[model samples]
Target: MASSHPRVLAIVLAGGEGKRLMPLTAQRAKPAVPFGGIYRLVDFALSNIINSHYLHVIVLTQYKSHSLDRHISKTWRMSALLGNYVSSVPAQQRVGKHWYLGSADAIHQSLNIIEDERPDIVVVVGADHVYRMDFSQMVDAHIESGARATVSAIRQPIALADQFGVIDVDPQDPTRIREFLEKPVNPVGLPDSPTEVLASMGNYVFDADALVEAVTKDAANPDSRHDMGGDIIPAFVDEGTAGVYDMIRNEVPGATDRDRYYWRDVGTIDAYFDANKDLIAVQPVFNLYNEDWPLYTGYTGLPPAKFVHAGPGRLGHAADSIVSPGVLVSGATVAGSILSPGVHLHSWATLTDSVVMDGVQVHRHAQVHRAILDKNVVVDERARIGVDHEEDRARGFTVTDSGITVVPKGSHVA
Candidate 1:
């Protein structure tokens, strides 16, 4: 039995041209960036959708969406085409040369398609964040509270609150949002800390009728920014029907406790780097190996990751690191690193606290530390990277002030 669950649908926004991720977003959408060795950035959202029992989903895509399109087709083929279960909605040129004028416009343009489905609830989301949540719970909360809309939220550090849409809610009633501001000039303070602020995760749940009305009305507002957080939320907040859901501490099955739910917005290079580093942490905040709440994506039938001459007495060794299938460490030394499939670390190379994506070849005697090497990149022999921030940038690579170098995909080092 499918159970008497609500007819919920997910609308994932993958349209934004991620200028911050740079070189990485040069050829692919932000959501299509490779993550956690085996999955794309979009997989995290899709996994949450399926796991949350929102069988019906439509990914709204634009702006360099070819890679995202191919990825969705390849991995999400299990979805039905004839039904309202699952599909990807790439922005077609039907509306003239102007592509997705804004996030609100994307939905406004797709209003007809959404209307055809007649879903009970529409779960709006961004494809860039990395986290997991059961949408069913949010739906349950929405129904019980009888709110017009609900925004997912999390507590951000005091210093970083200005960078996000700060939310002010009654601490007593965590569900009732008192005020909402989009990247406010002076963020509201948190109870735990006089300086910290609670920020919106940019995820939302709307009653089908409420969503249709809001999107239509917002579209007509000539001065509106055509963004949900900027225009729609504030409009509803004035009516006092908008609610808040603490995604960081939502009492979902897999995510509970104040500190368990890990949510990250990888909108900037620093944020992206921090999120990737979270995966390699001891007892990672985001649990990828949880079988009960398994993540889903299109599977590529690659051979199992292997380690030849591993363990003691071998020229190469990996300690406390995840070596994906098809990786050959050879005589290299890797510590606390993530080596994606088909990575070749030449003999005598050393990799520490780094993420080596698929098909990256580290030449002999080279050292890579606290760096992210994109797919198909080759580091020449004895070439030093991530050692000096100034030197790495001179070589056409990005080096964080902390000395973490980022080599873009298919980059050729001279």
Candidate 2:
């Protein structure tokens, strides 16, 4: 019994500093960081919204958002004649002369956009997650349940509950959220599955009036964190007006059984690297080639990738990898890696289990393994990376605890 169509406005939160993802985030915001060779992290969220037929979108941005702003402006252009737009709204300090204190504070400050649009339901989502979801289904469930706020919940193992905001549901009402716990050490398991807990996906569908009232009240509280997951959600849970939308129940077109519920929060270096590596698998857990629910981004006009030269001990070949456009694998042996656009590999260069970003030049006999080379990095002849942690750290490069060496942007290896 849901309405045929409701006035929906999508708000994407893209303001996190992403301090945990350093070096990669040094030059741009987390959402602006390139992913899967061509798309940015924010592209996943925006694609989902657009694919769901929600065209009126506003991205709230802060903390080094120049690249993020430019991406949205250039790529997400919608026809203004049709009343569609994808705008990036920065912190304007409309209420005070200070920056956004938290997520709720961000929305509280940008009330003007919401008021101007006058949407009946506001769908707010985070910018740094990789997932595909048809949010229109969640909206229907929210309307049917008559909840003031609806949070998208994903089933995560109980052992990993400490990593997220766990949701405790009422025993009698499976849809009603009993409590909201932030990174709980001992989380309550679901009724049917003892080893699984419902974790908030940081996506919410809010009744427009409820959202306005919650954020407005939270703004006046002196001790509140004013975060969406930390403050606004807990307030609605206290009022028994918050419902949970099971992500497992939401169906997206062209989703395989192996990738139906695929979602990753690439918040750290290892996590980001692992997520990128996930694409090279024979059967990726998160498939990128699903054309039915395609992931959209800015199109580059680069030519197709090329592989040249076939000499003794110097074969230009790549196995189990994704090589983007304009990449030239010249007499290089690439295995289990991702080569971004415009990467040029010289003769005898071997890259294994690594991510080479755009415009990188790997010289002859250089060996790269389990490493990330940022944009415009040049590896000198026979230079070794991800081979020695001590040497890498001494050379001012970052070496994660997992031993993933990262060469920052425009660095030359010798």
Candidate 3:
């Protein structure tokens, strides 16, 4: 039986090799990417933890974590005096380790600290996503199920399901997942319904003792892959009972609205761009304005976003976009795009169906469309970027056939 007052600890995995979201993630980690106008990608997880009343949060960081570390220090400086705190535990070469080889290895190296905390449950989450979830509910479900681990599962369209880790569950016992397929070519045949598949949300709650034991044991295995999903969970599941918590609307009244049940894995540049665009929609599926469940982030201390010389006739209007604080859009027409903080748009520069990141300066007469521009990029005057797919490809930029050009951060384009 689980304890009534379980001290839950959240271990956030922020040490991913973000290969797909290149340029933006070339220098910084994926979790530090700006999203939804003002907030970083990892803010979603931290807010969820704070809202759920969990104070002890440990973010495990590695692989170009300078920007991520800075963001955590600036935004998440909680009070130690009040017995609540959030801290980053970077990968140290203390254990004769160069860098965390995998998720399990990261935790394995940190077992001493985890065991010292002596918490009842350990909630592990991937930081590079945009979602609002009450992790306490997942913890409660884990206790109720009396399982070693409880994985949060979501239903997705079958065609896209194979791109994620798909699970096979028993009809009689929905919680009893039978098999795990990591990005299968054909996941439709593995699920009960042909149209939908049960996908892992990468959010997990584990028994603290079981987790520590698994990590220590798995670390000793010579031929193992040393990943949580690849080895730990599957090994524990084969040995004992592990449950699956469906990503359905929770029973928490006035809290778990249907629209609030949103989770995204923005692992690729296209996915990251699309997630940002969703926030600017009129009736966005992922509502950032839900006051009842406010998404908390760092205080900018800056004034609200301002738009100058924006009117119908002037043609310098910002249309269907979110312009964040301290932005100066002067005499430029922006349509279906998001402009992050400190973005300066000179006269006649047009942005259409794109995402311009923080500190970007669009010079006069430049046109950017169907693209994602990283931070601090300077678009020269009269330069037409993301104009045509063929042109962008010829210029050594990654322009998909659909005309989505991805400009990696800190890249120079003449």
Candidate 4:
């Protein structure tokens, strides 16, 4: 029996090596990659968990996690006096000589943490998504349903169900999962909509004891992939103990109706670019100024952003953009972009619809349009990015099918 006030623990999985988001992810983990200016991809998940008032968190890290670990340590310092903590746990090959085989394996290897804390309910979430969710609501639903595990799902078009791990709900009980289908062809639509299907969001809530037993049982199967979404959830579904939690129902404080339920899986470079663009809109699709549910990140103690040169052509101006602290726009025009901390745009430089990371330098007359520049990247004088796809490709830059140019970290575009 689950208590009404069950002790809940959160586990943020930040282990996957982001091969799709290259150059930017070259030296850092995917969750460590900067977004919106100063916030890392992982911050959104941690912040949401914290804001939900579940303070006991352990970030699971693997694959070049130094940057992610550092950010968690420095930015997520919970009050040690109160025995609350946000600790980063790296892969130590504790279960065996090999590293983590999959997401489930990652958890199975770190069962020691769960055993130590002995929380009643466990919340598992991916580190690199952009959204605001109140897991407390989901926990309540899970307890009410008395399900062994609940998978959070966002409704997607039935046509696109083949691209995601779709959950077929019990027609009799909409909350219970009938089957956990992975990218199935011609998935059945919802009972009401008939046009949408529930797609797994890679977030789950589990009864702590149930989770421990399931993972321990899964560890013995040599054929299992041990992935949470692909294997474990399906096993629970087969046992008739898995339920689905619709994400649309979980509301947060200070969320605008327009931007509510705005969840983005920024797995690729193009998707990542578009997510940033959503922040700079006139009425941004994703509002960052929601005081009741503010996004938390580390402060670098930098000076305020400065804009100078009001003269005719040398005017420093930015419109419909997000400029972080320590950014200097000295005689430049920025439109529909995000400038990270310590970025400097020189005189006559023009940046349009791009995401510029920390300490980047855009020299005089450089033009960047529909692009993503990684940390410390330099755009030399008169350099043009996204102006020519062929030229960008020839220069070893990545140009996606969507025509978004990506300059690698520390690269000089000349």
Candidate topping lDDT? 2
lDDT of candidate 2 at residue 275, scale 0 to 100: 92
The TM-scores, one per candidate, come to 0.92, 0.97, 0.94, 0.97
Give the range of the ten consecutive residues with the poorest summed lDDT in model 1: 250-259
Which regions of candidate 2 fall more than 4 Å away from where they truly are?
1-3, 191-194
Over 36-83, each residue of candidate 3 has an lDDT whose tens digit, in order, gives 878888898888888878899899999899989889988887899998
The lDDT for every candidate, in the order shown, is 0.79, 0.93, 0.81, 0.92
Per-candidate clash tally: 3, 0, 2, 0
Every candidate's CA RMSD: 2.9, 1.5, 2.0, 1.3
Q: Give the least accurate 10-residue stretch of model 2, judged by summed lDDT.
A: 1-10
Give every collision pair in model 1: 75-298, 305-325, 305-326
Question: lDDT tens string, model 4, 46-74?
Answer: 99999999989999999899989999999
Record all residue pairs in model 3 with backbone atoms less than 3 Å apart, i.e. clashing. Answer: 23-408, 23-409
Clash pairs detected, candidate 2: none
